[model samples]
Target: MQSSSKLFPVTLISAELRGDLSEDVYRLKPGNSPDASVELALTRLGRADRETTRGVPVVLIPGSFSNRRFWYSPKSIGLGPYLARAGYDVWIAEMRGHGLSPRNQRYKHNKVSDYVRYDLPAIADFIHEQNPQPVHWMGHSLGGIILAGALGGHYLQQTRVASVVLFGSQVSRIYWPLKVPPVEWGSRLLLKSFSVISGPRLKRGPEDEPIGLALESLRWHGLLGRFGDADKDWWAGLIDVQVPVMAVAAEGDHQDPAWACRKLMEQFGSPLREFLCLGKKQGFSSDFGHVEMLVSKQAQLEVWPLVEQWVRKSPEVAAQLAMQPDRDEASAVSADQA
Candidate 1:
């Protein structure tokens, strides 16, 4: 209900072309509930070729303490560019207080709840308004968790979603100590005293995460904790979601294991869902880790091509009535780069 605020206005900050690809940046101001002063940034990558018709849009969301750079590097050589080069419209989202998005008034107290309720829907609405097609969302780690929360809670519009791809993401990570009441409360107390978690200091990533995010996790893994908010049961809602999904986990990923990732995917009700685990057994050259599953040289030669196919061929709605398939959506996606 809180996310149902009036549609926010989007501002085009920059648009440029390099070689044959166009890179456009937009800033959206929600100016609505929970926090009205937050600014969300989206960096869109597509072809600058006027004669080339753009394909379906693919939105990439990064994990905790990370930014748009996860899918895009300053050298223009990540998944975003790869997708763009293949004629797919690519948008990398930088969450509140990260990358191009400046810290908001509620920066210190931000939680995943805020992201699921306020931020993602606005971004989804804006993307749908422009692309006018169900988006294929891909997320890594915390990014994937946010997407799962949005879908399970029914916060983001179902009609705007064509498919979802999650890499190394799961909410089922066990925290045995947090199940104890006193320990949980005490940890919460200590975390409340801090304003934010430093990413660089902990060597997790580049950006600092708000303390509220950690505190929120405590509530989730605490004894008898559920994934929903005040009024809805998100876990139960996942059983009703009909959108197709692809969930990938790595055998070397200790943070979110393949079995746990499978557990998460199994919760979805989509008839056309897939679960993939990357390892030598699965024909991958190596067992990929959490980050390596998406951002490694090995993945470049193997995983990236599969991802492009996942986006291109299927994921159409069952009825195929709401949208027209993207014309000239993809060319051959090259995976030769190391």
Candidate 2:
């Protein structure tokens, strides 16, 4: 078992300041089989104060091929800790076939349907069984696609979720074009070849890394940056979502264009919606890229405040937290009984 001290190094920028908050490993029951199981490696940082626990719990799902550890590093452009410091109870998740969770007989391969049918539902069930309160869901890139698909299906109705937030995610299967044609074709061929040769190579990390499966999920969406049929039906399913939602994009992310993010928001057609384009002019930047908003140094100053303010403003979430057992008080009660 990896201790929290070993899982997160102290030299990492955020850890240098905040230290290790709390960490735990969860064994998730398989939705499809009684004998099958999945593991979630989760870490929480920030206050254990009553006010912090009272705030809405934000479940952070990483993009495809990415793992929970991506958010832990000081150099991460991911958003796990920023939200934690800003007072949200942050939970970073690792999809099967990535990081600590590897494939088993039950989870044989990485498939889009597997994510929709098993991964999302499993996380929702785990959250409800343990916390028993509505949680706010946030996903990035392919993670966003999975969440969108799950919400459109029966999963949303079955889960006790409060709201949804998507960052740099798209509903359409077709992706925006790049400049060079050969570059585009070459990139596609490389990803396809990698997917075939790399069977479950996703377990490797930044130091001992393998080619990512994120491109596979994009391919599943038909967003390979080449011309293809638009996934309008899949896109249309998002219209069925009833909960409050906030869609965000980094101005610099070419992968998920600012225009596409705006278009997705327009599709929501709800009064309880907000969209933010971070950075100066909605274009690429040196510091902030597709994944930088969460882990970048700028996140503490620029992005977290907006998310913090928005979460605090939601009366439904605030009320939910107010009603839950206080973390410290609950701990004390348990201690006294012991």
Candidate 3:
């Protein structure tokens, strides 16, 4: 590991025992990236004092302007810790410039393309090397978009991925006006004046987002836009991704509505895919919001258990879903809308 540090230096910054979990923090410099200053933070949680765990490796990625704390609070009682307690190798990831991951040289220029093309692959490669099994990936909001982009862009291979669970993630959000070429061009020009989007000022989240990300989005949503990057046609490429996918959306989340989420999920070529809409109408206790769907008490009881089952079942359940008769898409959509 030390010898490989020259190529990708990984430093174990901290390790502590927190209740029933052992928390370890690592700083990885996948020095291979064009940006030499890029650093990423990864948090690993396992049963305290236990050298080996029983379940498959599970990775949790938080959304834009969020951190690992999005998955678990300070009390260590969030989904990350819950999964660790359930005997899964839990890993919480913080994207570059978020949380413990400090801003890099090109931080302002960093976009989702960079995340999918560089950061995610590095993190996945490292985790795979340590765990030696196909990993189950769970991402929220922008994090899920990053995961989807990686999959569609072929930054990650099906062999390295067991399954994907997305929470309130979609690329086709209500930005139809941006589809106009002139409007997109004007929007990009305006956004270029700023280096970052101030989360505090916007009252959006805890961290700021790069203008580069905003620019990339403008182009994607622009006229003749595709869910693709310079290197790959991600939107079209999703049809080739056969891995099982679970796209979870919230009725209360106007930011990424259930309809749009379902639209994205339906595009996947995977026969073993599902769209879960959380709301009282869906038999849930409350209409879960974007953040609340994962952090709130309602989520701990209702959502986490469902996620646990998905991770535990993985390929087996996915295979079963593929073999089952297709559920009426129109009826399912109506039910979710209701």
Error of 2 at 237 (Å): 2.3
TM-score of candidate 3 to 2 decimals: 0.92
**Runs in model 1 with CA error above 4 Å?**
1-6, 50-52, 316-338
Scored by TM-score, the top model is 3
lDDT of 1 by residue, 122-145 (tens): 898888777788899999999999
Give lDDT for model 3. Answer: 0.86
Q: What digit string (tens of lDDT, one per residue) describes model 2 on residues 167-279?
A: 78875435444335565556666665553333245442232222334444344434333211133344455566656667777767777875676666556533356677776
lDDT of 2: 0.56
Q: Which stretches of candidate 3 lie over 4 Å from their true place?
A: 1-7, 319-338
Q: How many backbone clashes does candidate 3 have?
A: 0
lDDT of 3 by residue, 189-288 (tens): 8899999998878998889999999898888888777787887999888888888888899989989998888888777777667778899989999999
- TM-score-superior candidate, 2 or 3: 3
Q: After TM-score superposition, what is the CA distance of residue 39 in candidate 2 from its true location, in Å?
A: 4.2
RMSD of 3: 2.9
